[model samples]
Target: MAEDPESGGEKTEDASSRKLGKARDEGQVAKSVEIPSVFVLMAGVAAMYAFAFYFYQNLMGVFQFNYNFQGVPDFTRLEAIRLLYVHTEKILMTCLPVFGAVYLTALLANFAQVGFVVSWKALEPKPSRLDPINGFKQKFTSRAVVEFLKTLIKVGVVCLVCYYAIKGELTEISRLYDNSTGAILLFILKVSFWIFIKVCLIMIVLAFLDYAYQKWKFLEDQKMTKKEVKDETKQTEGDPMVKSRIRQLQHEAARKRMMADVPEADVVVTNPTRLAVALKYDREEMDAPRVLAKGAGPIAANIRKIARENDVPLVEDKELARNLYSHVDIGKEVPVEYYQAVAELLAYVYGLKNK
Candidate 1:
């Protein structure tokens, strides 16, 4: 029942496929950014967890090389540069699995939300987009306010999750000070992994909710006013009045064509006063007699008048006339059942012509 401000009517009609398709071409789709972000975060965390042993080995090797060198390490510029290059390569290798997982997840999540859309139209520059009044209106819209609130809620949720996570591990955190370096590192990893998992789980729920809201909002935005629906119908299907007029013109053209064929007809079968059917047959060119024209009421009168003027024979056969008018279309041969009757009529007309 929401009213369209521009149309001054309720937006009660569902969007037509034409409008929805146009919106999609312009890169308008109901997709939640949170869905991709949450999936990527989860993927990265899972990748890091799966590659934890590899990370540990790499870190240990770097530590031993730097601090447990048996001899004083080479101090030449070349040696220093080589060490830096080796370390950079090791770091990149260590992070590669996590990066790959995040990248693939981001692509898949977006694909799942909106499929694969490459919209150049959305990227086009428009001066209307730079209008200060519209920009100001957009900033203060309900959607913008809702987005602001969502940000605040996410921050609050993350902080609350971190607080609970740390509180649960307070005893273990206190023991970390007395433990070996390896034990402290292990404890930190365990706590961080659990916290990351909890955040991901919460984000998954939020993402789904946000996606639902986005879809609902998209549909609402696509809703059409009654006037819009009517206008679109006219645009796509042509105005009903114009279409009716075209049909009238077509019917007139076809009638004129039918009347023209009456003069060439060898016989005119009539339902006495109401119906008329004109039939013509050529033994050399046609397998059977075809209806040249058929009509009722005013058209029948017209056909009969033309037949009289053209010296065509008028044969009153009520049943045959009704049968031809009802069952046979113009230009189609008479059916097998009517062949004997029509052949007799054709023979009589040809005999009269001989006299």
Candidate 2:
């Protein structure tokens, strides 16, 4: 079991959807820095390879422009500034492909990890982050150690790959001294490209591993303690005690409303002491008799008291009271099966009133 960093309690449960959503809202998500780095590196290498010819042509033009000056021509301040601006513009244009590739790759890599998230809460500054003691502790944390080791391994692997790659090209490199400058430059570019490609392949594997580890670590960090789960449940579903009270209040209010309708009921059928089902019907206004209220136990006793106070007729019928109380709901017309029984009871009450 992992312990919650904040509460120091055992986090025995997986994070709830609400917890994950809240964390996401705060811009906390599983992501590996290595994934973006590797992607950007690969993009830069691919861009450089594709744009090499274009860059060389532009660079050569610039070099020729610098060196192919006619005799000892004018060299004024304005001319110098103009030459600088032109050179700067050409260089920037030559490097545009690599820059664009890096920028787009970075965006894509990050998007792949966490989609598009913008959280002002994440941008907010926290004073706890400025605590020197906390900062010092963080430096020696397990995560920090893992990051440091990962960096070391990456650097070591890249160096070893570069070493083996160059070693394989030693024979070709040795003969470069005897070749033209252009041939030497071409050989160097080829060797560099191959070396970079090998490094990219290695980094790609590492990036996947890192991404998996990061996701696992993020889930672990988000794990909740049992108490926290209950507390969060209370927050979202309302506290059980409070909910019970609300339900009780609702039942009482409905009962009072039902009691108010007792004075208007044609009759109330009772199981004598156990059940009470108050009914109402009007020949001109109602299609059939309807249960105005029904209750058991204390509510049944209360209904009987209200019926007596309102002078509503009370008809004691064990089987009919049980059926009406069990089957009929308040404000609903009695079913056709009970229509004959209800009509007889209402007729008996009307006869009593006529007397």
Candidate topping TM-score: 2
Q: Which pairs in model 2 have colliding backbones? A: none
Q: Candidate 2: lDDT over CA atoms?
A: 0.90
Tell me the spans in candidate 2 whose CA falls farther than 4 Å from its real position.
1-8, 63-86
Q: Show how many residue pairs clash in every candidate, following the order shown.
A: 0, 0
**Candidate 2 residue lDDT tens string, 55-157:** 7777677767888777886889999999889999998998899999999999999999999999899999999999999999999977899999999989999
Q: All predictions: root-mean-square deviation over Cα?
A: 2.7, 2.5
lDDT, candidate 1, at 122: 95
Prediction 2 TM-score vs. true: 0.91
Candidate 2, residue 195: lDDT:
87
What is residue 26's positional error in candidate 1, in angstroms? 0.5
Model 1 residue 164 lDDT?
99
Top candidate on lDDT is 1
Q: What local lDDT score does residue 113 receive in model 1, on the 0 to 100 scale?
A: 93
The positional error of residue 343 in candidate 2, measured at the CA in angstroms, is 1.9
